[model samples]
Target: MNYAPENSESAAAAVSAIRQMIETGKLPADGRLPTERELAAELGCGRRTVRRVLDTLEAEGLIWRKQGKGTFAGQPPDPTGALAAEIAPDADPLVVMEARVCIEPALAELCALRATGEDVQRLRKLAQRASHPMDADTAELWDGALHRAIARIAGNRVMLTAFALLDEVRMGADWQEQRHRARTPETMALYETQHRKIVDAIERRDGAAAFDAMRAHLEALSDNLRTSIRTLDE
Candidate 1:
């Protein structure tokens, strides 16, 4: 606030104040900023000047805004969200699962072959989190994290992008509804076992075993989803 003179109405002064806030961690990275009105009041500037400052920060990759999500400090989120939303309507859960089954096993195999010591340790932590999630939301979150870790360890950029697209499409509400229906206590237990086996195989550097374990896990998921869809039709 002291970056600007008291009662100053200058855009330059407002920008300096906001930038200093970010630099000093008064505005934490990825944290939402004060509203334009609040910032304007604090800086003794008009909202127009505050708006200009925000626009300048965003253009410099220092902050970003979503339509209704408010301006946030730090670089903009990846462009994949926009792309995912665009293609989600056309995606079917079953087809997406099929794509995952095709891609993930190969990634798992590659991960077993190429993963560094650090990657294996991180994968173990992610697998542990997935194994004992507190609820459905956290289960999904950690499971996704576990799989994405394997994909990253696989070190195939093209395949990882493909995996990411399928992963994003599966987050659609319809897909979530179907997956939730398929998920039960028994299925969750089975998934945990399968996850451990996949991670174990990777830790052992057994490429074939990792490939087989991941494929089996995906097959189980596919079968469960198929059953869920059929039961709904019935």
Candidate 2:
């Protein structure tokens, strides 16, 4: 947990410590790391040294970072993230919803059947974070996390890649703005209820119920989004 740095080898020491953590599974794949400040403190090094170490690790494909999201301890997420960004401008939200309606229910069903106790626990925590989001941005973040958790727990690499692509597109600024605009108090409540239903079904290990709940939730989202867009056009 602590590393002593020689004069010019502080960055090297930090790198070794992080690499050790990764190798030992102390930092699991797709796991987020502590902030630069936190890492500096924990590693007994300067923030600059930590930064350099992170830069090295990132270039070596041992870790990756998103601007606002913290660094993660794995190879990057789906390579399609870049491609998603390129096509985001042309990706219709309704079309994306159609895809979700097709894919997410299956993920939910699989999650219900396959999720471990820890997975269900994490899902509950994510659901709670989403239901109590303080602002639109927070809501979007936790809500997306909740859905992604389900996909990950489903344990299908191919489906997860497809879902990740859609996730990246949905993270587009324009799409987020539209989603925010579409929000209303009643709609938020409905979403919260829907989220609860889906998580509950998964917790009970009822695949059919989980599938039905997820499909219902996505359908509701599609209906609300469509109505919001129509109102804006009018």
Residues 1-234, candidate 2, lDDT per residue (tens digit)? 334443657777889998887777876456888899888888888887888889989999988998898998877766697789787887798988898999999999999999998999999999899888899989988999999999999999999998898887877636776789888889889999999999999999999999999999999999999998898889
**Which 10 consecutive positions of candidate 1 have the poorest summed lDDT?**
1-10
Q: Against the true structure, whose TM-score is highest?
A: 1
Error of 2 at 72 (Å): 21
Relative to the true structure, how large is the alpha-carbon lDDT of every model? Answer: 0.86, 0.88
Q: Which stretches of candidate 2 lie over 4 Å from their true place?
A: 1-78
Model 1 lDDT tens row, 1-234: 334433434878888888888877886455888888789789878776787789889999988988987888887767677788888887788888898998999999999999888888898898888878898888889999999989988999989888888888887546677788899999999998999899899989999999999999999999999999999999
In Å, residue 228's CA in model 2 sits off its true spot by: 0.5
TM-score per candidate: 0.68, 0.67
lDDT, residue 195, candidate 2: 94
Candidate 1 has a TM-score of 0.68
Q: Give every collision pair in model 2.
A: none
